[model samples]
Target: MIAGISVAVAVLAGCGPLPELDGDPTAGKDGGAKSDSETGRGVNPLDNPDGTGPGLKVISSDKDRAKARDLIDKVATKGRGAKTGYDRDEFGYAWADSVDDVPWGRNGCDTRNDLLKRDGRDIKYRSGSNCVIASMTLYDPYTGKTIDWTKSKASEVQIDHVMPLSYDWQMGASRWSESKRKQIANDPLNLIPVDGSTNGSKSDSGPATWLPPRRDIRCSYAVRFAQVALKYDLPVTSADKAAMLEQCA
Candidate 1:
C-alpha cells in the first residue's frame, strides 16, 4: 500500500518525476492507443520480454503466432491442487515494496503504484509525493477500454495478477518458500493493470476458465500467462495449457 500524501512526502520528496515515455499526447482518454497502432499501448510480448512495457498487443502475424506457440509449448502442465488453505496474506501484504529480488521492489514505491506508473499515461502523482499516483488515463487491455481513473475512484482500475496468486498456489506455489512466493506476488512480469470488474470476474481462473474480453488480445494474454509461468517454473493444468494454445491457434 502507498503511504498517504502527507506521510509519503518527506520520505519521497526527492523521488523525482515519473520516467519520460514515448506516447501520443493527444490520444483520446477512452482510447489511449489503437489496438493495431504501434504507438502508446501496443507492446509486443516478444519485444517486452520483461513485462515492463505497456499493455499487451495482439500477436497477429503468422510468424509471431508461431513464436507464441513455441513459448507456450515450453510450459509444463499439472493437476491443480485443492484450494483448501490458500490466503492472500501468505504471499505477503498487498503490494509490499519491501519484497526482495523483484523489479520495482524496495524502490520506495508500492507494487501497485509501480504498475500504475508502468501502464498509465498522463500520470499525475499525489500533491507532494511521486510514489503515490493521484490520477491517470489508463488503456485497459482486459476489456479494450480506456479509463480516466483517479485515486478517489480507485476500484475503477485494478492491478491484475496475470497468473493470479491463488492460481499459483493451486498449481505449485503452495510448496514454495515465503520469499519466493513474495517475489511472484510483487513481480511486474506477473502483473497487468486492467478494469476492476473484469479482473474480479477472472478471480484466479486459468486460461481455460477465463480470458480477456477483447478477442484480439486473447492470444497475447495467453503468451503473457505462459511467460509468467515459465519464469517462476510453475505449471498450468493440462486443460489450461490447451486453452492457452487454442487462443493463438
Candidate 2:
C-alpha cells in the first residue's frame, strides 16, 4: 500500500548507481534519440533513448512493465527489505566532489549542456566556452508548442527526470557508493527536456499525482518512466503502478 505519487523516490533509485561526477560525464550514453524519422516527427534526436532508439519499439510491453511493477512492489514498502543501502537512515548523501574527493574538470561537459546540444536543433554555443550552448529549436510534442531554445529564453524549457531523483533516493538509492551515485546522476535513461512550466508543475512527482499536462505525451511519458526505473532497478509505488496501468495500457 505505498501511498502518494512518490515517483521521485523511484527516479532517485534508478540513477543512484551512476557516479554523479565522472571524469567524463558526457562521455556516457545520452538519453534522447529517435529510432526512425516518420515525416521528421518521430525522432527524439538525443544520444540514447533510454538504452534504445526512440520509436514504438522503445515502448515497453505489458510483460516488461509487469516485471517492473513486481520489482517496485517488492521494494516500495520501505523498511525491512529495502533494495539499496542508500535508503537507510544511517546513509549520508553528499555532492559528487565532496563525497568522491575528485577534482572537477573546468571544461567538463555537464548533463544540461549535453542535453541542450542533443535536443536543440542547429544549436549555438553560448560563447566560445566549451559546452555552453546558446540556442536551439525545440518541437514540443506535449502541447504542440514550438519553443526556441535560447540562452536567454531557454530556461523556459527544463531537463526533467522522467523519474525524479528525490523519489528514487527513498526507494533504494540512499545506500549506493559515491561513484555509483554519479553514474546514476548522469545516466541518459532518466532525463528529458520538457517545458519549464510543465516540469515545475510536475516536480518530483509521479503518474499518480503529477503528469504532463499535455495529454498527447502522457503515453510516451509513462513508457519512459517505466524504462528508466526498470533499467536502474528502482521500485514503483502502488499508486504509480495503477497510474501506468490506466494511462500507458
Candidate 3:
C-alpha cells in the first residue's frame, strides 16, 4: 500500500493522452476523433471516418487532399432521380433517438442536443441537465464565422444534413427501408451544424450546386460528403463528384 502519493495510472502503457473515439454499429467506420489546432473546435475529415467528430477543419495539406481525392473517387455516380412522392417524414422525425440504429442513438439524449454538445465550445447546459444545451459558441464551418447561440434563438444554429434527405431521396434512398433512411438522416457523418441561413440556402443541392462559403473548408467538407455517401452506399451526381474533386484539387 502506498502512502499519500497518488498513482498516475494509464489507460494504455507508455502512451500519451488518447484521442477520443466514437462507437459505431456499422463495421469498420469506428475510429479515433481528431481535433484541430489550438482552438480545438473542429476535426479533420480524414481522421474522423465515423463522422462522429465535431465538424470540418481546413484541409491544408496536399497529402491529405490527395487522400481525400482517392476517397471521393471511390464514390459511384448516377443521375439524380425524381422528387415525386418525396417527403421528409419518410426519413423519420428530425433528431429522434428512439432506437439504437445509429451511433449515439438511444443514449438518453436527442440527436440535436448530442450534436450541439459535440461541436459547441464554452457550452452551458441547462440547469441540472447535461443533455439540454442552453447556450454555446458554435464555429460555423459553412460561413467562416462563430455564432454566439442560445436556446432562445435556436434557429440561429442549424443542423445540416451533408447529404440532404431530399437529395438522398432523389439518389435512390427513395427505395430504402424506413429504418435505413432514418439512420442516414440522423447519422453524425451526414449531419453538420452550420449557419441557419447558409444551410437554408443549401436546401437539397449537392456539391455542384452548393458548398460552404468558407473557401478553406471546402476540401474537408467534400471529404465528409464523400464519407457519408460511401458509408451509406449512396451515389452523388456526376457534377457533384467533379465539384467535390475540384475542392481538393
Top candidate (TM-score): 1
Output the worst ten-in-a-row residue range by lDDT, candidate 1: 2-11
- Candidate 2 C-alpha lDDT tens digits along 1-249: 011111121122222322121111122124433323421123431234452232222223566445444434343332222334343223223112222322231236666666555455566775677678888666444333446767888668887767777667766666566455565555545656666775676666767776555443455566667666666677777777667656545
Task: Give candidates' CA RMSD values in order.
Answer: 11.1, 12.2, 13.1
**What Cα-based lDDT does every candidate model obtain?**
0.80, 0.51, 0.80
Off by over 4 Å in 3: 1-40
lDDT of 3 by residue, 37-120 (tens): 334348888999887888887788889999999999999999999999899899889898974557799899999998888888
Model 2 vs. true fold: TM: 0.62
How would you order the candidates by lDDT, starting with the best? Answer: 1, 3, 2
Candidate 1 residue runs with Cα over 4 Å from true position: 1-39
TM agreement with the true structure for every prediction: 0.85, 0.62, 0.84
TM-score winner between 1 and 2, please give it.
Answer: 1
Query: Which lDDT tens digits does candidate 1 get at residues 185-210?
Result: 99988899888887887777888878
TM-score: model 3 vs. ground truth: 0.84
RMSD of 1: 11.1
